[model samples]
Target: MTLLTIFSQSGKYLLLSIFAFLLISCSESSPPALTTTADSIYFGGTIITLNDAQPSAEAVAIKDGKIIAVGRYADIEKSHKSAETRLIDLHGKTLIPGFIDGHSHFSEVGAQTVLANLLPPPDGSVKNIADLQKTMRDFIATSPIVKKHGVAIGMNYDDSQLAEHRHPTRHDLDAISTELPIMVSHQSGHFGALNSKALEKVGITADSIAPDGGVIRREADGKTPNGVLEENAFFGVVYKMFPAFTPDEIAAQLQASEKIYLANGFTTIQDGKTTKDNLKLLMAMSEAGTLKADVVSYPDIVTFGDDPLLQSPLMSRHYKNHLRMGGVKLTLDGSPQGKTGWFTVPYFKVPEGQPETYAGYPAFSDEKLNEWILLAYKNNWQVLGHCSGDAAVEQFINAVRNAQKIYPGTNHRPVIIHGHFIRADQVPAIKELGIFVSAFPLHTFNWGDWHRESVVGPERAENISPTGWFLTQDVPFSIHSDAPVIFPDSMKLIGTAVNRTTRSGYVLGAEHRLEPLAALKAMTLSAAYQHFEEATKGSIEVGKLADFVVLAENPLTKTRANLKQIRVLETIKEGKSVYRSTEDEK
Candidate 1:
């Protein structure tokens, strides 16, 4: 690596949040001189540098937001130690590059965290209609949080697996609260379960049939929409019905989301999918310099047409060589568990108990989806499609092929997130087309049992979200937690990727297990590559940003069984200690 010559400040590094909560970054116009050098840098534990050239070290030096050196205690002590330096000895805790959450729904996840944590509707727990009625009564009976806003809003209910195995209709909701409107989003976010009042508010009725890649799931006998609005239908309702959130609420949600990531040692987060408005708030915060976490927000494809940022100052910023703007995101299909995702073949055989062989719904026509894909690629904004089913994955891959014909680049790494059910044959296209994949490794723990039984069935479940399989095929890949969807802990993610064991101890595709070293790369460097941020923050290398975490135990030296038990002790960003374990008992 080309090591740059830069001076660093010599003193104690303090976090902005510690005192009255002030913020300052390493750079602007001309970064303040780093000549006031700190001496004898140490973390009191193992530092597992992700840099392949020099894998482990005892200490790291930082100046001007860039790493000055990474090596052993004796060597660093001999050359860099001085009288005016501040040192942090972690008492033999593990250290590594700060983990990055490659994909997440920041706004939606934030909102969900604020709501009740009740199991989503269409859930197996709602054993019968009475159970569903009880839930509805409860959601309405409470004094509304935003009563002036005029709608009872709740989210993530999967009513499909219930004994009745159906969603609540307008009539059912009318029986409870006819005066106040009610709109509850399904677990998949593809559909909405509403009441008569809400339907009236949105002007949707049995006569209102879906126009595009949407469906109003209806009753077989009356043909009235059972209040299940899929794809376009759900987005349509939420976009209009729900009240806008205040800036403080937005910040609160973001802060709450960050706490979850910090405990997991993740200093960086890719807001996997967001709107231009959300992106604007982040930019305003960063420019005002209020943003704490390094965020990479990839706006949905719709923004490339109306408000393209290829030329904006925010799109091209480098915060202490930390945060960045990489590309655009596209929603291709609905959730597989919701039985709406497009599949080349019909979903697995559901017993008489389950309704239809439902996979999920797609958001666009094959032609329109393809056209949008080509447009995003041509515009120089790398595209990331949320395609999970085999057919949906095929659709995305086909779009990539189409885009390459007219416009092509070697580093263009358009990807498909949550490709949990793509076929084995498509593995070659990832390498041939230079596309990347940031898959959900945590799926092994959360839905491992469901995939084994209800979702994909047994035989094919072995092929689901196989990251290790991609490595064997020489396809570039990384692992992630779709954050509010799964806990955002890198160790937990690594465990899921390397262990493949479910809660019941049944290992899925044992041959697909990865080694600890390989899993680490997927969490760090490979993740940076997906976001086009490999040059700045992925690995702990000379001239790279000094962003890393201190752990309680060295992950590289431990076995897979102990990975999940590890905890993040401190998170350092740009030579400054941003987060430390306040709960650490002396």
Candidate 2:
């Protein structure tokens, strides 16, 4: 071979060798593109994210109890699928973010589960005073709680729904038991009836004067307490009558309450107006790792504002063992349905014993209210004020306004717990004060007729919750079922907000009704915002908690009147099932 031919051949071989080496190096340096795998992937049904940026998703991938990916099913499967991944097929059902409680007494609902069901039809069978007495009699005879506690108690009886349209008097309950101490709470939770024995046990007598913010309902003579107590009068005596439970019993009650919330699709629950004892009990439970769902407590400021525990690390936005002290609760007034909600104008018809000119009264003097609100502000604690009437709302607004003037530029996010009778004029101040309203639109379904006919008259009743006003004003708000007062049925809460229908089938306020999506937002996203947990919960977004609820039917597709018929099939929290209905198995 010639020298030129040898050199040319060698050069060709060297270039070829380098090209092969480059290929090998590139293959070794860059491993196959890594695909993120997830622990679980959910698909095959409608996914309502409650996130405006992505209103819907066909699938979601979860890892380490947080959403890792959300998009088309095919896209998620391509990137997140693995042999270890558990796939969840919704089977044409609906999946949405787990419901977050707006305003409800979680611990009290446990007590309600054990108490006699005096609620009217659909929840219980009590329809009249006689029915209430019979129910109490049955409870006294059959209930293990009564057997152990040695007292008969009934819960959630609405006088408005009774055939008699009047509160069950002590005389009525005396028929159930003059021997056994008996008490029945009004559905509103603002008033209560006691048997003569119960009255004697509580030491409330004809001479017992009503406290500053409560009423002791007098008989026709206007001197003798007729066995009925209102507001603080009921508050002052009711707890005294409750038999203290053993720690195990308390734990069981709390667990039972959590079960109800889980069954209803709630991942986050509230203990509004928690007392000191209950707060301590809950803290112990949280420390013991027994609490399953997240519980945010608003301890009653009037009682526990100065408690050392309130200053502890438990008072934080983060949960320790699924529990936290969110803030403090303040009661500005009573229930409007019970005629003690502190209104600026007289009710459409005065309650039986009240004078014609009587308007409801405040729970405390304005000075005390201002002091309490300012205390919360100075300490940078969020306040949840229970204000049902416009007058009470005004009081709250004024207090908040004054507090802001003193302690400006703190994102306290004060909340109005009920705001059932908030007037149109108050919307501006509510927005300006940055007060978020957790409204009770369930009242429209439960008591619209009573409100229209007796409480506030047709005109004012038309605006009971004022959801439409809030929406129009672009003010953020939330809807709630004041459970124990009514069952925390999420469907019923959403249906009421959308339809505004009364039990009698009357559309109390068509104009005030919300859209289905808006109502859902109120329950989920907006509610989380109210609790200052929007970033971690309330939506099915990447990096958020993997909390979701599966429903038998899509609430968005249901007719407005039928939204309440949608049933929860399963509730999943932190990528694990907490509740699954046996209806499918049956």
Candidate 3:
């Protein structure tokens, strides 16, 4: 046959073979070529996997975004190394499973950046009257936006502390523009200040009763609204004034926060609270391949409690790549420090209120809280309830207990997040209920002093956020920074956990000091395990996700203080170098 005829015959056979192979492989085990093969081998560094048996390693092999080999360099070479394999020598740097920040606000952090640039608050430290005057000036500059409905008002007032030390009163905001409405949120998000015009816009007056899960501040005479909105009450004001950002704008912001997260060494993050709009934005970004950070978004269920998505369909699943839709996050109570949370006992220090006998409020009734937990547990959703104070903790525990009674043998990993100011007595109950905890231990270090003087008295402050209590009780718990609120740099978390020092450099709880390895585990495998992804990632092990970080120093061998100084050299995701400090993006 001629060369042309021979080529034609060969092509026909190749086509037939391709069709046959596709059919056979679709019904059988993975094909040899399709099965991952390594392109790179990391052959140096102290690899810490958080797996107890093999806590450290000398090498790892990456192929198809998964680790095919993990062991000593010689061992990995025997099973996985190739002749043309790209080699990375870590030069004795520390390597561990990439940091997993269990709670963060990447979307909101971006929003905060934008708002801060567009609006400036008066320097709060400059005496009370001066600060108010500064606020008035800033409000005028932003008041022009009132031309657009729901003008952006109250972007700068901190409601926690003031001469009156309350939410910026409508009376004060009236000085800005009564003709145009305005609403400002508290830095804590627990409260909000509305201008007189905005209050009328929302139809909230002194006679307007507080909603079931919300509160409205009123003057002592109960004759007029004080302009402060709390919990669910503030939602209307925020949503009314909330400006919608475009998809591209949201993508840009998400990317920026992703960079911040990755730079600080967090490979994964869970948005503890998100809105439907935020969820839509994430969906848009994921479809466009713009979402770089691994996120498990759990939006607020309480706001939309009647939605079937929250009850029967407890945990929603997303395509497994980067962004995921986690279980719904509900804040049962407000911050303990803010004194808005529901507690069994009254707050240590009550703000200006009608009665001493009144315990702080809860958004959901006990019956409703129980109903929500039961429905979530029944649907097998992970309930990450934001409960910080002892009273809120107890309410959460009771709700969980009631859920168990209603539906037995439900292995729900209901997490009592924050665990702030929890007493030792609460642990046994929390453990008995089989709830997981993700403690914010850094608060013990970062805000311990402020917590000492104001929230919980200094004498009792040492008892706040005790990680050791959970440890001693064998609780299945993880620790995290409520990032944006506090950045989740693993080193800072470690420094805080091991030192138990406040931001002011005062050591608060010496007894609560955890080992360095313990802190690393919390940020890695422990966090991964919390999300039930331990089998796939969270460790430098054979047959797991090829996700690990190359560091400039070994945190394990270095001095305790050096843990804070350790730096990430490179970040690898799915065997690909996704980010590098010195090199250009490939």
For every model shown, what is its TM-score relative to the native structure?
0.86, 0.94, 0.83
Kindly give the number of clashing pairs for every candidate: 29, 0, 6
Off by over 4 Å in 2: 1-35
Name the top TM-score candidate.
Answer: 2
Candidate 2, 12-108: lDDT as tens digits:
8887899999999999999688878999999999999999999999999999889999999999999999999999999989999999999999989
Question: RMSD, each candidate, Å?
Answer: 11.5, 5.8, 10.4
lDDT of 1 by residue, 92-152 (tens): 7777887766788765666666653335331224444466567656755663454546566
**Candidate 3 minimal-lDDT segment of 10 residues:** 117-126
Ranking by TM-score: 2, 1, 3
Cα deviation in Å at residue 361, candidate 3?
2.0
lDDT of 3 by residue, 86-112 (tens): 888777776788888767676776665
Q: In model 1, what lDDT does residue 26 have? A: 25
| Model with the higher lDDT, candidate 2 or 3 | 2
